[model samples]
Target: MKETFEQLGKKGLIDILVVIDDSGSMTEEQKNLSTKMNSLLTSLKDTNWQIGIVTTTVQASDKCILTLVKSTDTDAEAKFAKAVQAGLSGSGNEEGIRQAVNGLKCSQSPWVRADSSVAVLIVSDEDNCSSRGADCPNSPGKTISYLTNYIEQTLAREIGKTAGIYGIFSPTVNSCKTAGNIGYQYEELMTYAAQKSGTTVSKIFGNICDADYSNTLNAISSNIALLLKNQFELSSAPDSGSLKLSVEGSVIPAANYKFSGKTITFNAGKEPANGKVLTAEYNVGAVPLFTKVTLKNTPAADTISVKVGSTVLAASAYTVSGNEITFKTQPASLAKIAVDYRVAAALKNAFQLEKTPIAGSLKVLVDGKAASGMTYDAAANQVVLNPAPLDGLAIELNYNYRTGPQLSYQVAIVQGAKNVKLYDGAKELSYT
Candidate 1:
């Protein structure tokens, strides 16, 4: 069978009935009701769904009147739109659910078919029924029982197999019940009826905020989706695997990943292994540079360009032997060594930097004399100037290397001076 709905074809339908409480008790938050109703109707219009509306009112006769509005014609959407605009207006009675359920039970429209999936949504705040007066010739308890039994035995039995009933109670009703107010009687009564009918109930107790609307609507849609999926026995959707890429020892999570028939692309962010490595775990495997590194997009060829700053140190061809690439290069300044690589079919490249080893010691000169008590380390990359008891003291750092000429290297003096005061024999240079 194709699907439950498809197998049954036109015989299957999804009917949603909205029962709104128009009694005086709902006057304070009529705006919220209208907003919620409009949002729900808008979401249902784009789908193959049918909806109906019913309003509850109290009469001078002290009885609950149920008014049903059929929403299945060419003008159904427009009519719902207009009804939501006109708003719900009523007074005298407080039993919205009683009228709603009665009207639903009596509705004879084609959209309310026996096989159609039916969902009745009730919105209310008060709990008393207008149908419970001595002149009405019915006790409140007995009348409520009759209504609950009617729903569970008749409507529920015929449509409950594919039908769902939901209730949204305003916060005012909850507060009243908790405060031991007269409204508590109605709250308890409705709770019983709902429990007996196997209906889902929720409470809305804050301002009509966007978050509240989105969350409530999402919950309703989730329930409907689950119901549809279960009835159709659909297959699970496909899963997308994770993309992997890295630079030297540091890894960059895959970016802008897309899959098309076994072909995947990492389009966003920098590609792994495009930059030089400033620090990394040394490798001793077939590739004696770095090891255990992984990448999602394999390079098209075994060759890649290794660069440091703007200078390309090596352009060699290599092969992925056990997921490692080996290259040869002449050792130069190890301070700023950058590693770069070109991957297969990749638009951009990846790189990393490696730290250089420090060499040489710093010699201190205070007032043209060897300051024997002063000491410094090259790894700290800085020198401290300490003034002695002598006045007019001159401090300097002297170091010699056999690889280069004895040209003066700029030394920064970070004392209580307004500028970086420089001194070369008798020449003094300072920058503010």
Candidate 2:
């Protein structure tokens, strides 16, 4: 069945709040963002876009980095770059969502337009948890659901406009070297915002580890354009290449429109007449990269989390088959596909003693049973089991040893001695 879209009254009005992490580790990332921000500006040139910058900190006074930069401003690009180059002196615990909500709460700036669509660009290498040690006590919670609600109900509803979230952070289940932690929650919110606002995941998220932001900025720009122009929100995200756009039984040329993940926008002058019915037919599914991925070990259902690049796929996106998972739509070729799950910890057989044991006082027990063939090497002061116990077996060691200062003496013995004689300086002791 073809899905239809009705044009909204608001046109091309977008307020982008860029929330940056100013932690010490974010130095290079900030520079990269500054250098590549122009790409986003160039893409949104046709829209009435305004940019606001804020650091991810609870202190409201110190939050606003750039108050306002409208699309028509002569030096908007430079202003945005300078603002995004938020110095690396802010909190390491980046509560990006909390800062975003606070930004929306700012009454002094008056930058957010009531009718404008909202897009929050979260530039951080950490999760909302502020894992590094910053406390976001003002936030409702550190979960994706709470953050999503803050973005939609608290921010978007307050402005009475459609909203979306974008990110430049780790795009995996686990953190990479550059990022403090994976942007799992931010990414989840990005997917939620994209699906709700008729945009694609790619358009709403970027990788912090990447050296350039050109492509990500372009995607964001295209999505903003979709919001600015008369567009239709598709019921399902479609493979852009397979999408077909038609108006009143007339096929629209590819150049006449742009198909984002779940939305289609007609170029400025190419919009169909008001009364015409626009119809779209497209196969629905993310483009395939690799249909199947084999996991190294069996994964618990509750612990399984899969990510294709920086986009965290919904649980419905893939199905688990044994230890292997098959995605309904494959991931991008170059993009990293990470599958995280819980496995049993490796069995441990050797254990260190708290103190050196008396020559024969050490005893070993495995699973409450006396263990045999166990030996203790005093030099190493550890207990070693010749045959290790099975996985999940508990091991217990019992030993008694002196715990005070230890001393040793070196002495040389003359040629042949019937009985060694020891002396303590003035007093001599004889052994028979």
Identify the candidate with maximal lDDT.
2
lDDT tens per residue, model 1, 173-277: 325342111333334444563354454534211212222454564455444332221111112212233223233445544443333332223333332222333
Residue 82: error of model 1 in Å? 3.1
- For model 2, what is the C-alpha lDDT against the true structure? 0.72
The segments of candidate 2 whose C-alpha lies over 4 angstroms from its true place after superposition are 1-11, 60-66, 132-138, 145-147, 154-161, 173-175, 198-200, 229-432
Give Cα-based local distance difference scores for all models.
Answer: 0.43, 0.72
Whole-structure CA lDDT of model 1: 0.43
Which residue ranges in model 1 land beyond 4 Å of their true spot? 1-12, 25-28, 37-47, 58-78, 85-89, 107-111, 130-147, 156-161, 171-214, 224-432
**Residues 324-379 of candidate 2: C-alpha lDDT, one tens digit per residue:** 88989867656888887766354456778888776667778899999987877677
lDDT of 1 at 415: 70
